[model samples]
Target: MEHVTDTPTVKAPAERFTGDVFLHPIATPAEPARLAAALVRFTPGARTHWHSHALGQVLHITDGVGLVGTRDGNVVRVRAGETVKCPAGEEHWHGATDATLMAHLAMVVGDGSGDGTSWLEPVTDEQYAAALAGPGR
Candidate 1:
């Protein structure tokens, strides 16, 4: 067995997200692994843009409530202790609810080298508003 030593603890930045909203990245791709994990804290009414993974991704909710939506109009509400999986190449976006601060562990497989993830444009406000309008209205 190989003994690992001296692993340093890294802290999440105050502002590590993109776009006009606030979402912190606890960990990133530079952490020395093919698998990347991040503790994303989303502000109310904030979310990620439409994107896809080359080898799929997983989200483990840690606190509050979150919303995950697909391009096909499938919106999933994930709560603490729940997990959501996005299949490879499936376009999707995730974020906090309109009234809650959501926190989740985002696990992305496959590094930037081969068959990486593709991040598309941000989710439009119209799409978000429609999602909040609830199902089959």
Candidate 2:
């Protein structure tokens, strides 16, 4: 049994996030362990850049509401207790809504090469607005 008190909470890099975001690492096992977990919090309107995982990712919403969008313009509104699965290599972005703070547990399965996610451009405001105005749950 290992107690984790060393990994510090980090501000999500600006290059990869828009607005204010925080990441609280939960687990990152040693070699041969490919699973990693973190609690990511997004302030109102904060969001990640488009990105994809080498394997896949699972997000379990823990607080407030947010939106998850795919390249195909499918945006999903996720609330507390909801879960979202992003398949490997699927380009996507997720963030808090314009009026709400959001938090979620992000569980990622890596491809054993250490870095598992490829981050792309920040989501545009127009895109975000469309998500809010578009029809989706």
Candidate 3:
């Protein structure tokens, strides 16, 4: 058994995120381990840029409300205790709602080539609004 000490939380880079976001890395890909995990926190209206993983991702909400949007213009509202699975190579973005602070644990696998994610572009304001207004929950 390994007792991991608490690590410092890092602010997400402005180039990759909008508003204020933070991350605490839990585990990272290393020799003989292809798994990566992080505890991500987003302030209201904060979010990541559009990106996709080569080996998929799993998000487990820990607090407050969050939104996940896809390139298809679909948006999903996830709350505490909800788990969301994003298929590999499907571009998506996730963030906190306008009125809520959100936190989640992100788990992902590496593709064995040290490549895990491909970042596309920042999500446009129009796209975000449209996603919020999209049909279905």
Candidate 4:
């Protein structure tokens, strides 16, 4: 087995995310491979735009607190050691809580197009506010 030594840490683009986010790719689909994985870090208030994957996605939280929400307005709080899954074509968004920095390992299956996700609009302020205001605080 070859050690992966060339993968680089990348800042999440502002066009796809809010606040500060970074990621280190752990694996990428190459030819025969069909899976991609990354370690993603998010600063407080940082989050991804609403998006969906062609073959589903999984987020395994490794640190701090985070929130994951769907188009239906259900926001779930996830903490370290927790994991969340989004079914294929299910629109969703995920990020650190407003006061917490969070990190997670993300895994996705590729659909042969070299791209697995279709990103939509940023999470509106009202949506976020409503999430934070939901029961359980």
**Which of the numbered candidates is closest to the native, going by highest lDDT?**
2
Off by over 4 Å in 3: 135-137
1-137, model 2: which lDDT tens digit per residue? 77767888899999999999999999774577788899999999999999999988999999999999999999999999999999999999999999999999998987777649998999999998999887753
Instruction: Evaluate model 4: give its lDDT.
Output: 0.91
Residue 102 lDDT in candidate 1: 86
lDDT score, candidate 3, position 57: 94
Candidate 3 C-alpha error for residue 113, in Å:
3.1
Give all candidates' CA lDDT scores.
0.75, 0.92, 0.89, 0.91
Candidate 1 Cα errors over 4 Å, as ranges: 1-32, 111-115
With candidate 3 superimposed using the best TM-score fit, by how many Å does residue 3's alpha carbon deviate from the native? 2.3
Candidate 2, 15: how far from true, in Å?
A: 0.4
How well does candidate 2 match the true structure in TM-score terms?
0.95
| lDDT of candidate 4 over 84-104, digit per residue (tens) | 989999999999888989999
Model 4, residue 48: C-alpha shift (Å):
0.2
- lDDT, model 3, position 1: 67
Worst ten in a row by lDDT for model 1: 11-20
Worst lDDT 10-window in candidate 3:
128-137
Maximum-TM-score candidate:
4
Order of all candidates by TM-score, from best down to worst?
A: 4, 2, 3, 1
Cα deviation in Å at residue 127, candidate 1?
0.4
Q: Looking at model 2, how many pairs of residues clash?
A: 0
- Counted clashes in each candidate structure: 0, 0, 0, 0
